[model samples]
Target: MKAIITVLGRDKPGIIFHVSEILYKVNANIVDLDQTVLEDKFFSMILVADIDEINCDYNDLKDKMDQLGKKINLQIKVQQEDIFNAMYSV
Candidate 1:
């Protein structure tokens, strides 16, 4: 399985490190990633992760990411690629 992970918040140090740490803990392999700052304050990232061998289920991973987001004062979300595509498809 694959998942789309998004993070958005004020730009800060260690954001990528913390996020990547969580993914690493779960053994989620990052396949693609794009991140940038907007107006010097908004930090946004989108990543495609291979979750085939992830240690936890989809919802569990999402929950963990959510908690991490809360701890870091960012907004983070994880969704299965298929569902994300379906929701955004025209």
Candidate 2:
């Protein structure tokens, strides 16, 4: 399975570290990632990860990411690749 992860919020330190930590714990291998800070204050990131061998259920991973986002004051979202594509298809 593949997943799309997005992170957005005021720029801050350790955002990537914390987000990647959760993925690491769940054994989600990151296949691609893009991140940038706009005007040096807003942060945005999109990551594609391979979750076929994750250690926990998909919902569990989502919850973990949510919790981490709350703790870090960022808006983090995880979506199944197929659903994400379907929703955004032209």
* lDDT, candidates in the order shown: 0.92, 0.94
Taking every candidate in turn, the Cα RMSD to the unseen true structure, in Å, is 1.5, 1.2
Model 2 stretches astray by more than 4 angstroms: 88-90
- Clashes counted in candidate 1 amount to 0
Q: What would the per-residue lDDT of candidate 2 be over residues 1-90, giving only the tens digit for each residue?
A: 899999999999889999899899999999999999999999999999999999999999999999988988899999989997788796
Model 1 segments more than 4 A misplaced? 87-90
Q: Put down candidate 1 lDDT per residue, 51-88, tens digits, no spaces.
A: 99999877889989999999989999887899967888
Give residue 24's lDDT in candidate 1 (0 to 100): 98
The residue pairs that clash in candidate 2, if any, are: none
Residue 88, candidate 2: alpha-carbon lDDT: 79
What value does the lDDT take at residue 72 in candidate 2?
Answer: 85
